[model samples]
Target: MTSQPRPGPAVFISAGEASGDQHGAAVAREIRRELPDVRLFGIGGRELEAAGVSRIAGLDELSVMGGTEVLRRLPGFFRLQRRIEGLFVTEDVRLLLPIDYPGLNLRLARSARRQGRRVLYYIAPQVWAWREGRARKLQRDCDRVLTVLPFEGPLLERYGVRTEFVGHPLLDAPRSRAAAARDRAAPGVRMTDSRRVIGLFPGSRAQEVRFMLPVFAEAARQLARRHQDLDFLVARPPHLPKSLYAGAGFPTAGAREVTERSWAALTKSGTITLELALAGVPMVVGYRTGGLEWAIGRRLVRIPSIVLVNLVAEAPVVPEFLQDRLTAERVAAELEGLLGERAAGRREMLRAFDVVRERLGDPGCAARVASHAIELLARDQESPGRLGTPC
Candidate 1:
């Protein structure tokens, strides 16, 4: 008697924040495009929901940021870990792709690997910055570390990990200011004045908002005092209530649903900086943390550049004021440099963004990542040992 064939492999994904959700959704969509029959499920948010990923748990609850805050949510985090581990054991997913939530995703990868599932880590954890030793741990746990930055490849290779620079996801975004300008033409809300828009991106995390919004508001007030023609838009995160900003004393043009084009942002560093660069919106990056966190991080983080644009360009294409430097005066000064003067230097920086855009390779990162995850699953089928029985 002929036996029935086993079904196509299932791929599980875990993306904990809005940015991860965005990247994960894109990857899921690409996965669907490439392998229509493969079952895809796991934890994600609205973007992943739109991308056809069935959710095991919502990301909103897991969106805590910073060292102390993450410690506060340890109980909830452990509960989520157990749930993912349960899936790895019972459901036996063939591949697990943890997008960017390293703290959570790294643990999930180790758990999945123990259960003999192939693990592909996309957006390699910032071990180069803080926990450099985790590179060895990742090399041990993950099947392949797919990094977005060019420099990360060499760094991880030094640790004997299989790594790939699949190009940055930002490159795949709409990179032309003209494209953004065109997209804006069809907008519903009419701005009081479209002359020059100043974006305020406090950040997606509540702690970031707590630290940055007041400073950003003060900077905005300073900007308004100097130039009244400029309009201000705050890029609010989905998990946050509009009242949060209102409570912070930030004057919003009423809380509109935050979109990619909310403003020419005074951004917090990370993926959003790359997004703004691709969107052709000029920005000044800022970051601040608790004093203890800052002191510890200052000692540990070895990289010269913290913001993605700076790292990708291997130079300071945009201003980054971090820690104590992230003050209203510094932010306002940088903002003035970007918007106030419109000097040749700013124009040159915008031109440099074009090169940065070219380097991002393509917006097909989600699709590429999905395809790679499928390949890893297939490889796992041929040799189960390869998932963890590393060379």
Candidate 2:
């Protein structure tokens, strides 16, 4: 009698937001290249779907910010978590690859580990910023943590977590040489009759947009009154509807194009700050959330700077107006410095960005992360008995 064939290995990835989706997609593509027959599935957005990952749920369903926001969606998240954990058993998933979205992904990692599945975390949770205790949890749950930031690997290693510095995926992004050169040469100097563009990047999530866009719009109006040559370009995430940006009263476009054309920017504090920095655009960072969320975050956050660019630079290279400080007047005033002809703040930030880029290391980051995950999978197959030891 002919025997039934054994099922191939499977990887379950969870990337809960736009940036994570982008990074996860790149890694997924690389994994497919190396292991063509491997089963790939995940919870991500269009990018991951395009990369051949069969999504159990779209990123929008899982993406929420702030404490209160997450609490309201907690029941759905719990149900989704249960469903995903059930898939580990039914599908015989060999690995759980989580990309960011630490709030949910951390719980999933613990669950996957409990089920004797290997966990490889990408773009590891910023435990260094707030809950340093989570580092120990990562040590216990994740088989390996692939970090994008240069400093994270060292930090995680201290907690006994296996770590790899995979270089930031943003370095692989296509950059506009013209834009970089202009920013480096002029440093936001607005010449006679030359149109200068200031990009407004509120954020990717609906909640973030709701909190930031109106304030950003008011800031734009204030700036417009002062500078006739200045034009506004809002960087809209593709997943969000156009109506979300309608109140901003600016032409909306993709983040890449907007960053390339921008002389300066007023942006939300996140990975986009790093993206703008890499593109050589000086920016003023702002973030606002529900009052309760802001209060809790203020108490929990241990770091001096929340902006990634500033954190990477180890200095406050960009002005951050967060929570109550995130007013239209403050944002406009800070951006004004960035737009001036001989703005020291602008030149200093541009110079710091150069150092930040060099520190991030070279590209091919996704390939490194993919290889690490694939290696972990191979090890598990070779020594199936070792899978449940650490957990």
The lDDT values for all models are: 0.77, 0.89
After aligning candidate 2 to the native by TM-score, how far in Å is the CA of 161 from where it should be?
Answer: 1.6
lDDT for each residue of candidate 2 in 335-355, tens digit (9 for 90 to 100):
999887577888888889999
RMSD of each: 4.0, 2.0
Candidate 1 regions off by >4 Å? Answer: 1-7, 175-194, 248-263, 340-342
Q: Name the runs in model 2 displaced over 4 angstroms.
A: 1-7, 183-193
Q: How much is the lDDT of residue 44 in candidate 2?
A: 88
Give one digit per residue, the lDDT tens place, for model 1 in 155-183. 88999999988988766655354435523
Per lDDT, the best of the predicted structures is 2
Model 1 scores a C-alpha lDDT of 0.77
Q: Model 2, residue 370: displacement in angstroms?
A: 0.8
| TM-score versus the correct structure, for each prediction | 0.90, 0.95
